[model samples]
Target: MNREMMKSLNLKYTKKREVILKILEQSNTPMTAEDIFTLTSKELHMSFSTVYRSLSALTEKNVIMKELRQDGKTYFQINSHNHKHHIICTVCGEVTPIDQCPLHELENKLTQQTGYQITGHNLEFCGICPKCSKQAHNK
Candidate 1:
């Protein structure tokens, strides 16, 4: 499947790229380049630079989504066609995917009002998660 996706994107298929994509596919939450590097390193001998470059290429092609959160780290995840947003815990860096897009109606309204084509959008909410809030309250 990863091979076909690369072929469709006109990206040259490489084992390293395949491993990276597999790692992202298996992950439930967004991962930093370092996180991917650690996992990829466990599976095969690959450098951090190689992993980073693969991520960049994939992100540029929209094969994956890149998000920078309040924690100051960039995270990557597969760009599913269903399209979803995320909410991050500002304290512990937990990422939770939001299945429903809250901005679709707003996007339509904006396109109608401004007469501009809305191609895409990115939206993420950040706040203390329940666990973090509970921990803080306990303290």
Candidate 2:
């Protein structure tokens, strides 16, 4: 992805934003602004406020997804473009995206039952991941 898309959306792209996006893209899961800044501050010469501002802009342009985790910290990830929900590990904060969309049928059912058109939905399942489960079992 390039800044041209953001330009079309009337959002100015910056190198700081690019570096942040790259970090989010390279990460296997979502990242907090603090975590991002900690990793890139030396190389990017930016502040926490700068990282936060870039994240807000990226989210505004729909270039990334921001989610408030149970930890009360906001996490960001590269927008997949394909709508998918995440299943998060409660103990370790591991977020895994599931491609299986179970809402299509549920949406149809809800619309048929209530006669109201549903525009969108969000579903995030939470549970202990295998690693956490194993650790618990060993203890």
Clash count of each predicted structure: 0, 0
The window of 10 residues in a row where model 1 has the poorest summed lDDT is 1-10
Total backbone clashes of candidate 1, pairs 3 or more residues apart or in separate chains:
0
TM-score of 1: 0.91
Please list the C-alpha lDDT of all candidates, in the order they appear. Answer: 0.89, 0.84
Estimate TM-scores for all models. 0.91, 0.84
Q: What stretches of model 2 exceed 4 Å from their correct place? A: 112-119
Residue 42: error of model 2 in Å? 4.3
**What residue pairs clash in candidate 2, if any at all?**
none
Residue 37 CA displacement from its true place in model 1, Å:
0.4
Query: In terms of lDDT, which candidate is strongest?
Result: 1
lDDT computed for candidate 2: 0.84
lDDT tens string, model 1, 1-139?
4677689988989999989999999999889999999999988999999999999999999989887766778989988866668888889978888978899999999999999998788788988999999999999
Candidate 1 RMSD to the real structure: 1.4
